[model samples]
Target: MSDKQLTELLSLINQRQDRLAFACKEIADWIDSQGDRPVAGKIRDSLKAVEADEVLVKKTLTSLTLERPLPRFR
Candidate 1:
């Protein structure tokens, strides 16, 4: 891949991270707004937990990407 492609890939990775952060915020808001027992609340809480413990997710993504070859591979 050219330098341009690599830069684009890194930009996409950053965008993905930003999207995850946005998802976490949305879930947290939903959880806070729930008054009664709601299944959505459970899902929201789960998302919050995952967002709070993102180190594992980061490591996994990094390891997986590092092990994969670039698109230019034969």
Candidate 2:
């Protein structure tokens, strides 16, 4: 992919990570308020995905930064 495209994708990926983190935190808080249960366990698993997404985003950013492409003027 072109550098511009990669940059845009990185921005989107980071944005998604941020959103997921916010949602996961809120869900965890709600679960805590509701008391421990089987459902809370499931919610915790989803929160773990947010952590994974952060790692994925970091990987994507590393790959994007290591790549080089022809410059485009607009």
Candidate 3:
């Protein structure tokens, strides 16, 4: 795929991830309110991984959009 396409794909993926993370946090809050602190903590811990992955995705998208493209090797 072309760089432009890759950038677009990454952007979409990032948006989806953001939405999922938001929804998960909401659920975690509800779980905590219900007194299931352990499950809520687990959900939050899982969210940390998602947050890290989001950083990497953002970095990749930035590189794709801001850096010059490498020459094709064909």
Candidate 4:
């Protein structure tokens, strides 16, 4: 692939990361707004885990795309 294509792909990845972060924040905020309910705490904990996983995935993707060169196969 060409450099232009790689740049475009990276841009898209960044946009997606932004959107995912926004959605996760919205969910967390909604959960917090819901007063001290029995399940609210559990749900908030689960969302936290999901957010952590997202960060890991995004880091991996950024490393794979920006830090390392892509291999060309015959």
Best by lDDT: 3
Residue-level lDDT for 27 in candidate 3: 100
Worst 10 residues of 3 by lDDT: 51-60
How many angstroms is residue 42 displaced in model 2 relative to the true structure, after the best TM-score fit?
1.0
Tell me the tens digit of each residue's lDDT in model 1 across 24-58. Answer: 66776676677534755665666666577577656
lDDT string for model 2 (1-74, tens) is: 87768778878868887887788778877877889656767877777877777777788777777757668999
Arranged by lDDT with the best first, the candidates are 3, 2, 4, 1
Off by over 4 Å in 1: 35-74
Compared with the true structure, model 2 gives a TM-score of: 0.60
Report RMSD (Å) for each prediction in the order shown: 6.3, 5.3, 2.3, 4.5
Higher lDDT: candidate 1 or 3? 3
TM-score of each: 0.43, 0.60, 0.85, 0.49
How many residue pairs collide in each prediction?
0, 0, 0, 0
Q: Identify the candidate with maximal TM-score.
A: 3
Q: Please, what is the whole-model Cα lDDT of each candidate in the order they appear?
A: 0.65, 0.76, 0.92, 0.67
Better of 2 and 3 by lDDT: 3
TM-score of 3: 0.85
Q: lDDT of candidate 1?
A: 0.65
Where does the lowest 10-residue lDDT sum fall in candidate 4?
A: 35-44
Which pairs of residues collide in candidate 3?
none
